[model samples]
Target: MSQMLALAILILVLFIGEAVSIRTKAWIPSIFVSGVLFLLGFWTFFPPEIVTLAGIPPAVAVMLIYLLITNMGTLLSLQELKEQWKTILIAISGILGIVAALFGIGTLLFDFQTVVVAIPPLVGGLVSALIMSEGAAAAGLPTLAVFAIVIYVVQGFAGYPLTSIMLKKEGKNLLEKFRNNELTAKQLPGEQSGTTEKTVREPRMFAKMPEKYNTDFFKFFRLALVGYLAYLTSVLLTPVVGISPFVLCLLFGVIARSIGFLERHPLQKANGFGFAIMGLLLFIFDGLKNATPSMMVEIMYPLIGCIVIGVAGMYIFSLIVGKLLKVSKEMAFAVSLTALYGFPADYIITVEVINSLTKDEQEREVLTSHMLPPMLVAGFITVTIVSVILAGIFVGFL
Candidate 1:
């Protein structure tokens, strides 16, 4: 296929997936739909080089990871994180559960290599999958690399309905409490009762810069600078600290943002986030080029086993920790499941459940106030922070 034609087809598939996700309220994820289409295309007549033809090479994808993750760092709110400490504890416990269960039961059922490749993606998302796939490929285990991607592709199917059900149950329970006056909007956990307390804004380093002078090019330069510093830090510290460059990128991004060296969501501010994400997605799907129907069939048993075992572990641990922490079991489990599909899905599911349960604006506000914080915090902790760290650690086992 011509380069332009290939790129168009890729974008069309992405557009279709996104449209479907929006219409269904993300009951079906865009990545799932896009992944299936890519697999089918590759299995049939589509050329293996289609992703390259579309102008997203591996190096481009790697570069995007740095920029995008650095941008992700700028999105952190230290105050919000501090307030949601219980949610953070529960989220971490849930990940530990996945790790223990997978290492114990998963290794017994599958080979050590299969379990290793499956665990990171099970606990995280694309970056974890990318880390594991690249590690597996470099270790000369193409099937395991494909297995990592497959886990990322299908795990959301397991997470979405389960989280939706949990959130709905929790929402209904909270609504009942609200109706009976047992709970007030001000009584919601993790929410401030009123805005009586003043917040002191930290001084930003670029505060004096003219608005027009803070151009997109300048934003990109700041993001790239942080990314490069992250790379340099990783090079110097990896042997000493054993952290990956990507993990350092996320950390430095957070530090850079905290110090006001970078703005919040810098890539989005620069209008480059979507294209960066597109390039990364193309790089991820490019792995599908080597996968055959038989290879997929071969990994099915281990794939299914890892997800089942991992989620079961997460649920069990989250429930135990939630009970001890005095959190609702439903809310805790829903938060734990953020590992499966983070961010907008977590946000979407919370809103959808609240909307479905009540029409009262006050009730909606009450429910959102109680539920959204834990869910969002859990996602940031697991998918954004823990996963990359875990992937960096897990990849070495391969």
Candidate 2:
């Protein structure tokens, strides 16, 4: 297929996917729909070079991811984080659950290579998947490397509906509480910071930036510069602090917001950034086109086993942590499931859940404010940060 035809097919499939997602209320997410469409399109077009066009570099993809997460930081409240530390803790516990479950049972049932490839996708997104696959390939386990990508393609189905259903359920519960006067916007546990009257000191981080260059473009450029600085800082500090660059991006984002370098609105308004994310999603789907049917069938048993066991572990750990944290099981389950599919889907499902359940403006606003932070943070901790770090370590073992 010509490049133009490939690009046109990509756009058309993406459009149809979005239409399906909306028409179905995201019971079938756009990414998954588009992924299937791409798989079928690949058979028809057989354009071997399509993946090349969609093949964004890891650094670029990570930067786009960092930009998204950093923007998320600007919307977060330190006080709310303090109040909802339990949710954050639960998210970490869920990751641990996957690690424990996958390594423990996976080693016993599957070969070492199978265990290695299966574990990474369970941990997070395409980055982790690719990391494990490359590691396996380097170790001369070509089949395992291929299986890793296959798992990455299939894992979204595991996460997408669980997130959608759980969020919808939670939203309905919140709506019921609201209608019965049992819950008030101000009384939402994590949102007490916004409800209370307290004076907070403003940190002028952007005081160094002259007001003359404060156009939207300049503001976004400044944000991107800070993100790059954060990346460089993470590289330097990785030797000392031993945290992933992505995690450091979160810290730098908060710092940027505090110092007045990053503004929430500019990120919220960054159309290009949003499109980049969509492109990344397409790139991930495009990878699935490379997987032959025989490969998927060959790994089917281990694939199902890994996902099933991983999910079981997540739920079990979530229940224990949720009880200790005083969070409900539904919320715990919802947050933990984010490990399966991160970011845009999590964000979209959370919004859909809230919108579907509430008609009141105040109720919707309160629910959104309360839900978004944990959902976003959960994805960040499990998918972007911890997963990559874990993949790095697990790959070493492989």
Report the number of the highest-lDDT candidate.
Answer: 1
Off by over 4 Å in 2: 1-5, 51-63, 186-213
Q: For candidate 2, give the lDDT of residue 108.
A: 90
Q: Weakest 10 consecutive residues, lDDT, candidate 2? A: 194-203
Q: lDDT of candidate 1 vs native?
A: 0.80
* TM-score, every prediction: 0.76, 0.86
How far residue 140's Cα lies from its native spot in candidate 2, in Å, is 2.1
Clashes per candidate (backbone, < 3 Å): 0, 2
Model 2: per-residue Cα lDDT at residue 261: 61
Look at candidate 2 and give me any clashing residue pairs.
205-259, 206-259
Model 1 scores worst on lDDT over the 10 consecutive residues at 194-203
**TM-score, candidate number 1:** 0.76
lDDT of each: 0.80, 0.73
Model 2 lDDT tens row, 1-398: 56666666677888897788777876676776787777777766657557455445455565667677666666655555566677778888887887788878877987766776687678688889889989889999888888888887788778877777777777778777877988766443222354331332222455455656556677668768777887788788777776666666666776676555665535655556556666666666767776677777788898899899898888899989999888888899889988888776778778766766656899897788667778877887788877887788889877
124-219 per-residue lDDT for model 1 (tens digits): 877889899999999999889889988887787688778877887888898899899898763432123552213322226877766678889998
Off by over 4 Å in 1: 111-113, 125-149, 160-203, 341-398
For every candidate, C-alpha RMSD to the true structure in Å: 4.9, 3.8
Cα error of candidate 1 at position 135, Å: 7.6
